[model samples]
Target: MSKFNYVLNFSPDTWTPSMESKAEENCLGGIQNFPFAPSMKIDRLGAVCDFSYTSYSRGRDPKSSQPDNQDFHLVDSRPFPKTKVRYVQRKFQKETAQAYHQKQQQQEKAEMLLRQGKKNAKMRQAGTQQYQYSRHRFVSRMRTLTEWSIEPLSSWISVAEIPLSSLPKQFLDVSKSTIEDIGWFGTLKSYNKSMDRISPKLPMALKDFGNMEFLQPTTSDDEILRDALLQPEKNIDVAITDQILACLVAAAQSKYSWHILVTNVDGKLIFDKQDGSIIDLITVNETSAEPPLPDNVNKNNRPHLLGLEALKSNQNYTQNIQINGDEGIIKQFEPIPFSEEHQDANVESKCYRYRIFSLPPRAGASSSENAQKTVRVAIRTEIDAQIPNAESENSGFIFARALNEYDPKTVKTWNTQLESQKGALLATEIRNNACQLTKWATQALLSSCDILKLGYIVRRTPNDRESHQIISVQSYKTKELSAQMGLKEENAWGIVRALVDLLSEQPEGQYVILRTPVKHVLRVYRIPDEESSELPQDEQSHKE
Candidate 1:
C-alpha cells in the first residue's frame, strides 16, 4: 500500500491509547488496513510533536510497554530505565498524600477561624462587633475582593461608525408605509411630468420608492405585522418577507402565476401560498447550502448600508444571477446558506446542479455519491481544522491564513490599548494603523506553521476504558512536507508555512479593468515591477 497522509479530525480531539486500540481492532477486523499517526508540527523554533490526541492507537503492543507520545525513544536515544516509571508513580503518590494531609490541616484551620469570626460577628451584633455586621455585606465584600484578580477588559467595542440603523431586530418596523402616507419620491411629479421616459403601462411602473422599501412603517399594525411574522433573533423583512416579495413580483412580471414557499432562515415554512388553494402549510425536512464569496468583497457590503459596518460585517445581500434565461438582469438574490448550523438552507450557487444535470452519468459512480451533505461535511471539517480554538479566548482568535496582507494581533492589541486608555492620541494612532492587530495575529499564526502542520491532537475523555479520549482529538499530523531551503526537520515548519502562504498570495496578482463610457477591458497584473514601475525604495520591502 502507498503511504498516504490523512488529516483526522475529532469533533471533541487528540489521539490516545484506547482510540489506538479501537483503531487496531477495526484494522484487525478487516474494517480497514494501514497505520496512522498524528501529524507532527515543525516550526522555526524546531519541530515538536503536538500530541493533543491521546486516543490514537500508537501501534499493536505485543509487548506490554505503552507510552504517551515522546515517552519512548529511538535506538540511539537512551532507553527509559526500568525503574523510571515506577519511581515517577511513587513520587506522584507521595506528593499526592502530602498534599491531601496538608489540605486537611488547612481545612481544619479554616474551620476554626470561621467559627472564631462568626463568634466575633455575633458579639458585634450584641453591639460589640469590630466591623460591618451584615452577613450579606460581608459576602458582597468578598466577591468584590475576588473580582480584583480580573483584569478589566471591556468587551464593549466603540465602533468607529455605524450606518444610520441598529442591528436588525427580530421585528423591523414596517419597511414600507402606504403610498398615501409617504408618497412616491422621484424627480417626476405625476405620470404627466415624465410621460416621455417610458411606456408606463408595461406591467409594473418603475416609480422611485426612494428609501421606502427599507423604511420602518409608522403604523402600529406594521409593528404587529413584524411581531407576527419573524423570530426574535431575525427580521423577516431581510430574510423572507421583502426577499419573497421581490421574487414573487419578478415571477409575476414574467407572467407566471407562481406562488413560492418562503422559509425562515431556519428553513421552516413561513409562507406557502401555492397556486390558489388555501395557502397550504407544508414542512419538509431541512436542507443546507454553501456559497463562496469574492476575495475582495468586504463582509458587510449591504447595498442599503452606507459605512464602516457595511465594510466589516461580510453579510450577504445580493448575488449576480441569470435566472431562467442567461444574460438576465442582476436580479435580487439570497446566497444559499453557507453555514450548515442553520439546517434549512439551499445553496444559492446552482452551478453544480446545472453542470450535473447537463452531464451524462458514468457507470461506476452513483449520483448519490455527490450527496451535498457529505461534500459539505468534508469541506467544513477541512476548513474548521485550520481554525484555532476560540473557546475561553477573549475576543476569540482569528485564523491568520484567511487574512489578506494583514496581521490580527497588532490590530487587536492596539484596539485593546485604545479601549483601555480612552486617550485621543492612542485612539488616533490605532485608527491610523488600524490593521496592525489583525496583521500581527495573522503573522504569528503563519509564522508558527509547525503547530498547524503537525495538527493538534487532544484527548477529551480522560477515563474512557476503550477510548483514548484525553482531549477529544483522535490524531493530527501533517502531510509529507517538501524540503525547502536548508532547514532541518525542526526548522522546516515555519519556513514552509510562510513559503506556502506567500506563494498562495501574490500581491501584484490583482485584476483591474478600466471602462470608457461604452466599453470595458479585463486586465491582470502580478506585483509591480520595481525597475519598470516607480516603486519607492522604502516601500519596496513591503511588496511580496
Candidate 2:
C-alpha cells in the first residue's frame, strides 16, 4: 500500500550501505521514467518535501493561466528583511590577554618579595652582634684547637657480669646462627726456607719470602650476595657484605674521596664498592699531619706500596705458622688450597671468617605502625686468624696486621721506640695511620675477635726494599684497642642505621654515595636504567 514494503529512515549520521541499496531498489521505476534524474533523493528530518510550488520559473507569458502581474506581486506576501551585519566578540583572545597580565603581575610580585626578604635579612644581620665582623675578617680568623683533653686509660674497663635472670627477654632471645664460612684457611706452614724446614724462634727474613704471590678474591661480595642471599624471592632490608660497615664507622675521620655503590632492588638495599675501588687498596699514613707526597720517586717509600708490602708480610707470617694440621680447630665450611685460578682464592692470611650479625631497629624511627616493626639488617664481618689458647681450653680469635717501617730516620727507630716508648710509638701511629687502624679495630670488634695483634716490621737495610725483619709483636684486647682509637660501638652502629634509613626512603633504583672532592660530605646519585645496563658484569663480579 505504501511506496515500499519497508519504511526507509535514512540519516547521514547513521547511514549504511544496506540503506543505500534499498533506496535504489525503491527508485527503480522513477529512474526508468527519468533516465537523467538522481537514483534517489534524501531529505533531512523535519525538512519540507512538497515540490508542487518549489519549481523555479522564468517570466510568465500573458496568455498563460497564471496572473500577468505575478512578477510584481510578492510570492508569499513576506516583507523584505532589513540587511544587517553583526560582529561576534572572541572570548579566547580576552582570556589570553588576561592570563598574560596575571603572569606578569605574579612575576613582579615574586621579585619584590625576594628583594624585600634580602633587605630584611640584611637589617637583621646588622642588628645582631654576632654579625658585626667584616666578611674578610671573619673568614680569616685564626682557629685554635681545644686545650681540654682526656687521657685514654691504659687499664681495661671491666664490665660487671649480669645474671641471666636479670637480663631482658629480648636480650636473652637469640636468632639462629647465620655464621657461614664460605671460604677456608690454607695449610699453615712456617715461613722458613721451605715447607719442610720450620722454626718458631728464628725470625724469617723478607728477602727469603721471595716471589710470594698475593691472591685476590675472584668472587666479589656483591656477586656472592646476589647469587646466594639476594635471590628474587628473598626480601632483605639491608645488606652490608662489602665491608661497608667499617667505612661507615670511620666516615667522620675519612680524608680521601671515596664512593659506595648502593642498589635498591625491590626495596632491598645492597651496599657495594666499584671494581678496584680505593677502599680495597690498603692505605698507609693517610691521616698523618704530613702524608706522603705523590711525587715521591721511591716506589717503596709510597704509602700504597708500603701498605701492600705490610699486608703481604702479615699474610705470610700468619699462614706460615705450624698449626700441626689443626684445620678443624675452628669451624671452616669448604676448605681449599690456595690457587691462582681458584674462584675463591685464599686472600691475605689464607683465612677469612664471615659472620652475620642482626641489627635491631633504630630507636625513634617513626610513629607509624610499619616503623614499629623490627627491621632486620644482616652485616657480614671478617676475622683473620685464631690464637690457640695454651692456658685455657677456649681458643682466642685475633685480627693480625703488620705495621711496616721503611725509613727509620723519618719517624724514629721502631725497635728502639717500641721498647722504651711503646705508648709514644702507638701515638705516632695513631696520628699517621689513623684510618687504617680505625678500620682494623672496627673489623676486629665486628668479628668478635678476642685480641688485636700488631706486628712491627722494619727493613733490614734502611736503603733496601727487598729485605725486612719483624722486630716485635704487640697484642691488645679488642675492646681496649677500640677504646684507644676513640671508637664507640654505639656511634658506629648509629651511623650505619642512619645510612640504612636514608637509603630506604629512596625509590627502588641503583644509587651511588660519593664523598665530595673538596668536602667530607657524602652525596647520593641515582643511576638511570640506560647507564646501569652498560656496566660490565665481569668487572663488577671480579673486583679486588
Worst 10 residues of 1 by lDDT: 375-384
lDDT agreement of model 1 with the native: 0.24
lDDT of 2 by residue, 347-369 (tens): 33344444444455545565644
Tens digits of per-residue lDDT for model 1 on 386-465? 12233432212111111111212244432233234424423343233222222222222222222121111111122211
lDDT of each: 0.24, 0.56
Estimate the TM-score for candidate 2.
0.56
| C-alpha lDDT (0 to 100) for residue 385 of candidate 1 | 16
* Poorly placed runs, candidate 1 (over 4 Å): 1-544
Clashing pairs in 2: 189-320
lDDT of 2 at 163: 24
| Candidate 2 RMSD computed on C-alpha atoms after optimal superposition onto the true structure | 33.2
